[model samples]
Target: MNLDQYLPVLLFIIVGMAVGIGPLVLGYVLGPNRPDDAKNSPYECGFEAFDDARGKFDVRYYLVAILFILFDLEIAFLLPWAVALQDVGLAGFIAVLIFLAVLVVGFVYEWKKGALDWE
Candidate 1:
């Protein structure tokens, strides 16, 4: 291994650090220092913190969050599938269909169990 091969990697690390830290330093120096009650208060899931931070949360809150993540990840698969559609051909299409079918079944199960109900 030659040092020449590592030069780009070193430059990339330096650039990444600059990109990450530059805006943060600039914001601290240039942004307004306006803090109020709302800004200082602890917020949880868009609601004001009412109970002990470590206390149990409603199971539905976690269920809804998990459902959102599940669908979000499913949609993420579409990007790669779309890119490789021609390469994968019909088998990929069928595999995605099967994946969607399983998701729909889980969705129906959750719906029947009232996991989606707000109350």
Candidate 2:
């Protein structure tokens, strides 16, 4: 392989790295070196931390968050599929319907099990 062909690609990579790291390096070298008691404190809100920083949270919060992401991504798949509906034809349409049906079933199951209910 001719190495000359890769010169532009190598330059692109080097420039990309410089662009990514240049500002960070500049900021660290040029930034102020000021660390007062308020800055060094564990909590910076001028109030002492009443509880441990690593506190245990209710699992439901994570469960709901995960469920939200799962459903959100699944719904996102519909956007491109909708845009290309004519090209994908009936088969794609039916496939999306089935996908939506499964989503509905999962949502209904979660709802019936009170997974969506917050007290």
User: TM-score for all predictions?
Assistant: 0.61, 0.60
* Candidate 2, run of 10 with poorest lDDT: 42-51
Model 2 scores a TM of 0.60
TM-score of 1: 0.61
For model 2, how does the per-residue alpha-carbon lDDT over 1-119 read when each residue is reduced to its tens digit? Answer: 88999999999999999999999999999999897776666563434544576866667778889999989999699999989999999999999999999999999999999899877
Regions of candidate 2 where Cα sits further than 4 Å from its true position: 1-50
Best model per TM-score: 1
Candidate 1's displacement at residue 10, Å, is 14
CA-lDDT, candidates in order:
0.89, 0.87
Evaluated at residue 18, the lDDT of candidate 1 is 100
lDDT leader: 1
lDDT of 2: 0.87
Q: Residue 56: error of model 2 in Å? A: 1.4
What are the per-residue Cα lDDT tens digits for candidate 1 across 23-76?
999999999999788786767665566546787777878888999999899999
